[model samples]
Target: MIWLVTSICIQIICAVHVIRTGRNQIWMLFIFLFSLLGCFAYLMLEVMPAYWGNRHLRTARAQVAGKVDPERDVRRAQRDLELADTAANHIALGDAQAARGRYAEAEAAYRKGLALGPGNDWGTQVKLAQVLFERGSSREALTLLDGVPEVSRGSEWDRRGLLRARLLADLGRDAEARALFEDVMSRIAGEEARCHYAAFLIERDDRVRARQVLEEVEQRARRLDRTQRVAQADMYRWAGEKLAELRRASA
Candidate 1:
């Protein structure tokens, strides 16, 4: 009798969570049918994630990585640095720091790595530039990228091109900025690049083009697989809101 009552209470709790979260209301059917197991699954899959938020989610990823490899990213990086304080080791440390959202620490680590190589490590320069760009130091970012030779291929080139375009635009070099922005777009930069371009267009008073770009982004996001949408939720949400605002302004 106690078990029966407890199971019912759990089901009720899970159902309420599902409703309040505006989750697939159909999940309530699973809760109603599967009893305690359903409630447990729902709690693990839904309630726990929503409750933990982004910071905790990042922490959880670290924990999972630790379990998969006992010496996870930061720990392994530290171990490597202890054995030999090399540029590669510092780069690893910088990567770990950036992964944990410690941008300032990452910048310092990347700088230390660059100092060791004395301008020979294009990789280190790019990484330091990335952290600087992320922290809103665009001029510093540009200075760092200035030392690195331009790559002819791969995602690294795309990142550098996008950042250069953004920084140029921010500094009011409109002609150069627009050309690079179009280059990024022409290269089929993903949803993120599209979103950034839309924002840039809006800022430059090209609302019609901005609306078109954002509408394309909104459609792409709507077509994303469930798992991808979940992983890219923040970006998708922002783009959707932007599209809606543009639409309403036109109306």
Candidate 2:
């Protein structure tokens, strides 16, 4: 009896969804007449495609693929590079290497791309600088960033500035780093800059200001849609965890 009731309820729900979503009224008939099978058909035929296309699901699929074959992207990138010894191919391989934390290989690929005269010289330079910074060459990274075009703007510009700021902070140029941090954070809508700034403040024992910055991240997170939230879920979670730790310490 319970099974029958549940199946009927599911059929009714599916029928209603088909109607409300305008997903072919024929699905409603198929749903009601065929019971659970009809609901399954509706889900498979009507609902699943939309869900599969969701950004979170796409991200999950990529992550699963990465875990299943850790070096899949690197192999694919190398294959492309072998097929075409082009600047973009080198950069792509570098990106794949960087994603896998093979910083030395990534730096080599980025340099080759730059040597081949990449269409986006600044972009390749920034990637090389990032890999250099990751490999403990902050001064060299800073020099590369210093040569980026002055007209750069948007996300790439923000990334370049954030990296330079981090390099500066590591080099004990706190005042310069702070100024750059503030400038980059003001230009972007995301929490990455703010999170980095909060970390910098925490390092300096300015927990109060750090807490305020983290609280602001929390507030912004609350307003984000599901896709946006999922995209930066790690940073948002880190902000929340850091904020809790700060509160505990103050208490």
Candidate 3:
């Protein structure tokens, strides 16, 4: 009985880790099914080595010596830097650089933002978390996000929270991530939030709820900012495609 309890606890921990990492559900299931032995096997066969491999990969890929559109990225970074000497500009520059697939630049921008005064700036923290997440450092991202104060809760914070939830889901903490996502959905009635919530529902196989959330998103989109509305339209387009795919799969 104690062994069983231990196994259950290990499974739960593994699930939470997978959810936090945003890893494969199948892998989590395998760990749960095999219990402690399975968990150990997973750690040995997958988790530990993958973590080490990813760390090495990141270190090796840190430097990008390429000559592309030098003016565009530099100018874009400068413009964003000029807008708000705040940490947000650094995040913005990081995002811009990331959009261009310049991971090193993105990291530099995030680090620069972190160096400037308040290292705990919410927006900058989220941007840095995002970059870390993309770089397979979900655990590190979680560590950073964990430090964000509740008093700092806002749209950007909520978005980061959702991202953290997604990471959790990937790591195998589906229940926790689901609860967090639901909380975010409750607070955010906006189109983007609704769309994201719908996606989360779909992931959980809650098709009906997902559909309802998408409809709500579409309705709310009508009253949002022009840019947000456009983004909503794009979300709807993607939702439509997903719906079609689901239908076809069901059929």
lDDT of 3 by residue, 1-251 (tens): 98889789988888888788875566576776777876775565546543465543333222211121234555667786887786667767887788776777898888887787464567677777777777888888888878776646777667876788877876778889878887887785455556666787787888877776666655665676554444345676876676666656567
Clashes of 1: 0
* Segments of candidate 2 deviating more than 4 angstroms: 1-57, 118-120
**Residue 201 C-alpha lDDT in model 3:** 77
TM-score of 1: 0.68
lDDT of 1 by residue, 34-124 (tens): 8987776566655565446665455444453344344357877999999999888999999998877789989988888878865678877
* TM-score against native, each model: 0.68, 0.73, 0.56
True lDDT of residue 10, candidate 2: 94
Report the number of the highest-TM-score candidate: 2
Model 1 bad stretches (over 4 Å): 1-72
Q: Cα lDDT of model 2 overall?
A: 0.85
The per-model lDDT (C-alpha) reads: 0.78, 0.85, 0.69
Ranking, TM-score, top scorer first: 2, 1, 3
40-148 in candidate 2: lDDT tens per residue? 7667655765457667656654553455457878988999999999988999999999999999999999999888973568878888999999999999999988887
- The collision pairs in model 2 are none
- Among the numbered candidates, top lDDT falls to 2
